[model samples]
Target chain A: MTEQLVLNYSIAGDDFTKAGEAAADFKTVLKKTGVPPDIIRRAAICMYEGEINMVIHADGGDAEIIIGADKIEIILADRGPGIPDIELAMQEGYTTAPENIRSLGFGAGMGLPNMKRYSDGFDIKSAPGVGTTVKMTIMLPKNRE
Target chain B: MKIREISEILGAEVLCCHELLDTDVHSACGCDLMSDVLAFVKDQSVLLTGLVNLQSIRTADMMDMKCIVFVRGKKPDDAMLNLAVERGIVLLSSPLRMYIACGRLYSAGLAGMSEE
Candidate 1:
């Protein structure tokens, strides 16, 4: 617990079926680290939503997770078309994902909002043509120490 | 209620994790949208959805749900079943539609997610 554990994953964008694998893998790792189940669930939800967004909107992305003693940080960065209006994108039920995605049980416009809801710290940086980067941090429970 | 009772109530076929059917689930959520399920659901151990895809399984796994009932006779494909097996999530295919399935479960004492 003294050293930070860093994990990196490359999310494949073309396959919708594989979207949450990274988050699932990370969830296992977190469980093995003895993190509380509630904290693990929150971190898993945040990463899963971010992974879905990267696949649905961005082509693909890199997810970097840093697990420290007091907090878990998730950084998702994608080199795809970025959001034009972060404000609008943050609103619930305001997704731009197409019909196919909705049919697959996503794109309800709750991704970003859900990520923010479960994370203790949330931030996003996007440029219309460049790409987007999202950083979310979940604080571990005080009792974990 | 236990997952076995849920399967019996909905006339659902247990697709995987049959050994876990005796697991108890206190609350449930019925939704087709994974995002909404992830956003609104809290500590709900059962998910009833018509959406048949891998994301449904993944969402349930993320929420730490124990069982997923595919309503409206929807069946999950092999890949999804395999994933559910790995995640230890019980998969059920029910003939009942979304509304009837939810109502039946609620009537059977399975509560929905609490309004927060």
Candidate 2:
């Protein structure tokens, strides 16, 4: 028996302050749905980072979250300058963001790393000049109750 | 240490949550980098940062921080204050800079980031 919920959101560009609103809203829904706190936190962090990435680089993007009985899947698609080097981007402390973003308390190059850290499975698909799509899965420990 | 004590020690202005000033906080983390706070700091009820932005409050809320102290006389604007009020998080600003404010609290027994 499988139960699933899929959520879709459009992350707006140019509003850095409003970036985390979607994740916060999801946390509320997750709480109402009786998901474990740890599992909610993992999904929150992953989506929050992806939200920031969308605003910072792609100017905007689309996010889809599929919640399953055993796992949560997050897919973020952005129409921006695609990642030229996945390996370089994955390296902690390496970022292409400007200093202005750093002043905003981000761009320390931990976004991707943190997403990977909080998620159980991670996948990336991108092509330069076209776009990038990041997929992440976080498994819920069944015995969390 | 309680937030009220921190205010007394530094003579800082309580920008918001005056009623909640007596809330006790066992630990504090001082950092301008929100990512560091997210990645490293945990369970610290109070956060001291020079950065002033809406995201600052959001980050603190995400971490379940109870209070945010803006060091170096940095003041939060209306937007940040509104959000803090909604989240019931105290907001304070002190002219004592990051070092002196942190030291005063440390001497008073509030554990620093690593200790937290």
Candidate 3:
């Protein structure tokens, strides 16, 4: 467990049903590494929220997870239409997700906020037509505390 | 409350992970919005929702929830059930609507999430 562990995943946007697979798999990995339960939960929630956003808004994306001794880092990058206003998008109750996605119990305007809430460090970069990338880090507990 | 008791109170049918019914749950939340459900964090909690999509299961898993009760006779698809089984999350189908189901669980001593 001394070395960094890196995992990459290509998320599919065409299928809404498969949205959370990457997050679920990453959770399993974190559990196997014996990370603290709370830290693992936070990391998984961040990843899951990012994955859902990638599927719903970004069309699809690439997820890169780096597991280190002291922290877990997740980078989700997408090539879909980027957010025009990061401030507004980060607001707790603002969402641009379509009605169809809303019907499926998503697009509550909480995805980004939730991700930021659960992570120790959060950053987002998006351009009007370029794409969006989100980086989140969750600090792991030392001495298993 | 133990999941079994919650099941009994709601008259819910176990959809998956029957063996985990004996697990204890301290708090519960009923919401179709996954993000709202994610705002509160608790140990050994239960999620009661009418949302039957995979995100429901995923949300429960993310928050370390022990069980999910699909209200209003809503049933989860096989994929959702499989994910629940894989995550070791108990799934239940209850005939009661969200409001009544939460009321029944609350009356039965299952508390909601504490304000942070």
Candidate 4:
């Protein structure tokens, strides 16, 4: 594992049914590459939440995962309408997802918070009419810490 | 508790992966919101919910949950079931409502998520 592995995925807008596909694929790659189970699960959860948020809010986006021996980094870049308030969005129970999305069992205002909860490092950049990019990192366990 | 025990307690019908019923499950969480499930659940192997959608199965998969018990007689459609099958997650359908089902599982020694 001397080299960093990079994986890229494109997400389709409004495709609730296919929301988690990229994260699932990423998890598979992590599993095959022999990442620890707990680290893999954390990465998958963050990726999945971000992936779903992309589909629901940003109308799809690009996901890039960089895996190294020390940590895993996930970048979700979406060109959809950027979030209005980063502070509100980070709040646990605030969401702007429409009723239709709510009907599908998402949009409980937990996506961003959940992603942050699972990742060791979290950063977000967003503008009103531009886009949003989320960078998340989960450190690999050292001595099972 | 074993999945089989959960089935017996909830009187749920195993919809897929019957062979895995004997698998052990440490904790359970019942929520209609997949986002909440992803946020709060840690090392929980069973998801009991009434949300019937593809993401439900996807949520179970991402969390490494072993079984999903659909309460209130809510059953997933064919596509959702197919996804569960692909993920190797066992699906169970129970006529009990969410509260009753959770209560039954709890009374039978099936615990919910531990406080983090």
TM-scores, all candidates, are 0.97, 0.91, 0.96, 0.95
Q: How would you encode candidate 2's per-residue C-alpha lDDT over A57-144 as one tens digit per residue?
A: 8998999999888888999999999999999998888899889999999999988888888889999888999999999998876743
Judged by DockQ cut-offs, the docking class of candidate 2 is: medium
Estimate, for each residue in B1-116, the C-alpha lDDT of model 3 and write its tens digit.
79999999999999999999899888899898888888766674899999899889988988888999999999988888889998999999999999999999999898887666
Q: Candidate 1, DockQ to 2 decimals?
A: 0.94
Off by more than 4 A, model 3: none
lDDT of 3 by residue, A16-91 (tens): 8898899989998888898988889989989988999999998899999999989899999999999999999999
Candidates in order have lDDT scores of 0.93, 0.86, 0.90, 0.90
- Per-residue lDDT of candidate 2, residues B1-116 (tens digit): 78898888877899998899888889988889887777753568898999999888877876768899999899999999998998889999999989999898899899976741
Per-residue accuracy of model 1 over B17-113 as CA lDDT, tens digit each: 9999999999999998888898874789999999888999999999999999999888888999999999999999999999999999999899999
After superposition, candidate 1 runs with Cα above 4 Å error: A143-145
Candidate 2: regions farther than 4 A off: A1-3, A143-145
Candidate 4, chain A: TM-score? 0.95
Candidate order by TM-score, highest to lowest? Answer: 1, 3, 4, 2
Docking quality (DockQ) for each candidate: 0.94, 0.65, 0.81, 0.87
State candidate 4's DockQ. Answer: 0.87
